[model samples]
Target: MNATVLKFGGSSFRHTEDYHRVAGHIADRLATGEGKIVAVVSAMSGITDNLKEVMLNVNKKASPSNVDAALATGEMISACCLEAAISRLRIPVMSLNGYSLGIRTNSDFGRASIESVDPKQIMAALLEHDVIVAAGAQAIDQSGRLTFLGRNSSDLTAIVIASMLGEHACEIYSDVPGVYTADPYLVPGAQLIPELAYQTILQMSLHGAKVLHHRGVHYAEKHRVSIICKSLTSDGAITGTIVSGHGNARSVTVARDSPVFSCASLEECDSLCALLARHDINVLRLEDSHGVRVCIVSDIDFAQRLVSLADIGPVFIGLSNVVTELDSSGLLVHLVGDYDGAISLVRQIHEQMYPAVVSVPFGASV
Candidate 1:
């Protein structure tokens, strides 16, 4: 009835050998008497996109249900790989996919919202195994069809597991150890935020920070589950930031690759926005002399599906990047037409808010 919940993102599995490495880490944790653990896993890097490309190439008009079935396989394969690695380490381990995860959602396919979670199966399995690897970002619908929660949503899966099992905290491992004032890779001056409030992090995610999924943050906040952001390294696990009820920081978020569409009329844009919101998609509306432009920063494919479903004749205006700065005053959004400009603006804003640390050694002064 008691277990620790952890999640490993795609970046953790860049190569096949990384699976064994993660399994070794899990074994090491067990050696430290961490007790039974539930490790949620995402698809190997680029595999989901590859799968989607192959599926779409074969059938451009495939139903969303079928697409979900195809995309869900990536996580299932990862679960199997990690399970095998753990078993090779002479550990009692099992893996579960959407079919048996006991988490149910509506038939929303690409961005399904979790409706109910029955932890009996997971608990029963834990009684027989020390580790249970649950495929993340996937659940089943009422009709028992596979459903993908959303892109980069494995975080939600991990948090949901922790909440259902009555755990107060969960660990999420990614390429970056924790959240930063700006993307560390792009902005050399970016500083790692040691702690952040639930709402603060949630806004960052909503603006396309990529550190965590917004839905997952919302769920964690609602369930009062603290999120421990960490990264596994050669030395060991490094805890970067903890997200709970308190803490605040000024940060800049840049969503470099977002799709934008031009609606013929304001009414059409409004209708499309409402439709997308119902499916839990975040949209930014911009009005100009030409028409209404709607930008979708996350779940682009699902947003396209919704647009198609609505039969709105919105012209594709191509991708527009978003750079946002959040501080004590408020959030300021900047829409850039090019990636270079977005990156430049991010550095400029990051430098202004985190000025004193810009000259210090990267990743050291913070």
Candidate 2:
């Protein structure tokens, strides 16, 4: 059962035509003697956010289970669309969603953790079809209810699928060619990294690099799976960086605006922090002139819900990014006033870190 696992991020499918483009790529791979192909796809660009917005706008108090069900539709639609495109090419293809994917998770709806994976279904599907499109970042709980993995979590789904299916490596395609010293889109001086250690990328993700999900990297390390990051272009697929057991480098990461909750006292802050931690939410504690504050860096919506459930009134701070320099020494975090400032700091940090390489521009040649 030799199969090639590939994941196409939301950026890959910005419109309906993009699906056809990707389908063509898959067909070409199959035609080129690539055996079984398993493609994990995310929702079309901004589709997930659009769906989430509509769901929450109508029912602000929607249960986690219900929200998961609504949010998973984006990827489901993507899977089906891709399947249709592949079918149009007269290729034997099929699409599977959370229900049929055979990956089971706990009842932690918003950020469900995988409990087990039964690859028989996927294997059987692959045996019948040339390409199998699996909806990313979704699974079913013990009760068979739909559960979303998390925001920007399609990477995790792809890695898990590759590992469970006995595949040693998985290729992830996104807007960028590969991991860079900083986000290439924002930092023009950012240079593409050819390779990286699992631990290094994991730390980058943990501190706020968007190249890969931290949880996914953790799972890949445990399963000894190598992640090949690439970008799909009109010319074809271009390999960028490979994440495995070796390589080292310094990078800068800028996190999105995190929800900050002001706690009255230190005890209250610690208690709230522990509760969030138990739920697997990441938080950072801070002491300021006002009092104690807990910054929710993981999933802001889920964190807000938990805070409300705990009967705590969260003080909403304006959007801000926490920029950090990642290296062997330690993390040097800087609190940026805004996203612009964060990008500026990232450029400064990246320039200072790799001054000689700042002139290089990333492209297919890399």
Candidate 3:
């Protein structure tokens, strides 16, 4: 049997009108014989943020368990709303919470991993129902404790479900039309890439691209699942980025001429690592020559957190001068297609920027 999993982001479920739009989209797809379109939905926009605020107010040092409990409510509410929307259409649907099903996970709380998912009941229900609205980002532990997947957890939910069902495709519906060379809002004249190899998307996601979550992309790559990212506003017709298993072997070349800030002290290193880990920041490299130099590509919030941690006297010292060189405008150029083309591009960049190549860490080759 053919199946495609559909996942909608928080922004797509912001209001009742948005729910109607989702229902309409599903109905249209159902009419076209789109077999077993499992729907994975995120919380309404800003609900998770509000929940975090409440958690912070209750306890300044909220543990991961407390945070998971607070955040899981967002997805619960979203699932309920979506169930109602689907029901209004007289469609047979099953709204499931992670607890209701035997989706066991570890006790990591905020970043829990799924230990096992008993899909027998879910599969049976899907066969009889028109839609299955599963709460995204949440799972129950073996001890019956609620756990949450980290940020953008909805994408991970869709991927896991698709993998379990052996679905051919997983469609991620979001506000953006598709994956682009750079964030269109930040970079003018950025072009949307029609097709991307799985490794290319993985690299882009790892390097701060917000179109797809890293865990979700990794899962899809592992399972050889095709992923299509499209805008919810586009009626699902305007094709977005198609990520598949096979593509021409390619290499990406990136060059930057920015001053590298060096940090010293074991305490500083530990503190930075902890802060970045908490924020799910990805660090590319950390080298120690005369001093400690760490390179990372992440969101602005992560950078701010690092700066804040550095301000304290315990972990870091004598590194204030290096902080002034921080630039948010660092350009990242990625070339993904043919391997020969990638090599040519890297050669061209190396020639243009004749600085000693200090570090070159190989990323996904697609």
Candidate 4:
């Protein structure tokens, strides 16, 4: 009836030593009188990609079902490895795949949608095992074939389990300490968002913030399950970022690493927008430069789609080799929360917290 879920991404288990370190974290948590904790783990880093390559080499014409099975081996392997590592720490731990934990999905193979989870079985397992290590991403269909839940589904996996048990929050441990205003690498002065609204993070995630999956955040928002994003590669007691429904409503900016398609006219823009929308690809932003219009190609799928639309190359600023001429100079600024009033003009922008922090060197700590 009560539990805490810990979700670890592939980056956390990059090596055998990493597994040992993760186990140490788990063991320490259990020691702190945390009754029952469930760990939803992803495949080790590079393991999933390597497994997909194996499938490609062995069978060029492999079925979607086979690909699903191959892709799942990474998480399955991770769960087992963690189980072993934790057991060595003198803790009782058990590894369970999505199916074993009652995670059911639709028959979508590489892009499965979780339909339901058997809470009875999950509860029974928690009663018997000190730690339940559930494999993330991959689940079984109605016909019982292993299927993956798209990219970053491990976070979804943990959220689902936590929601099933009515837990308020799930702790997602990753390499990054917490979500930031922008990619720290790009904006070196970017500040860590101490707390954020779920909707804010969801938009950030959708607009190419690699902190967590949008679907995962959607599930959390719908189920009222908050998420805490922290770093596994950090020192003691890092609280990280708490993503919930309550936060200051302000325009949050996030940048993405992608290109844009500049349309010459409003007619060209309308057609291009409609086409990409039909394919379910989101255009991050649109800029009107005098008589010309530009559509930022933030979504990777949209970029791929441009390759076959060479016939309409001229429509997009007379560029036939559209994909070849990727404009990496542009970055996306995703806005979160709501704001009223129409903008008179669009000029310059600023990173998260401002260019206004005056420190009084001679004053007392304030």
TM-score of each: 0.97, 0.95, 0.74, 0.76
Better of 1 and 3 by TM-score: 1
lDDT of candidate model 1 versus the reference: 0.91
For 171-287, candidate 2 gives per-residue lDDT tens digits of 999988788888877777787789999999988887788878888998999999999999999999999899999987889988888777778777788789888988767677889
lDDT of 1 by residue, 1-366 (tens): 679999999999999999999999999999999889999999999999999999999999898999999999999999999999999999999999998888999998888999999998998999999999999999999999999998889999999999999999999999989998888888887788999999999989989799898999999999999999999988899999999999889999988778888988889888888888887677899998766899997678778887877767888878889899898787899899889988988888988887787354554534
Q: Candidate 3 clash total?
A: 0
Of candidates 2 and 1, the better by TM-score? 1
The lowest-lDDT stretch of 10 consecutive residues in candidate 3 is 318-327
| Clashing residue pairs for model 2 | none
Ranking by lDDT: 1, 2, 4, 3
Question: Weakest 10 consecutive residues, lDDT, candidate 4?
Answer: 338-347
Residue-level error in angstroms, candidate 1, position 257:
2.4
Cα error of candidate 4 at position 234, Å? 5.5
Q: Score candidate 3 by TM-score against the native.
A: 0.74
Stretches off by above 4 angstroms in model 2 are 311-314, 360-366
* Candidate lDDT values, in order: 0.91, 0.88, 0.68, 0.70
Which candidate would rank higher by TM-score, 1 or 4? 1
Residue 115 in candidate 1, Cα distance off native in Å: 0.8
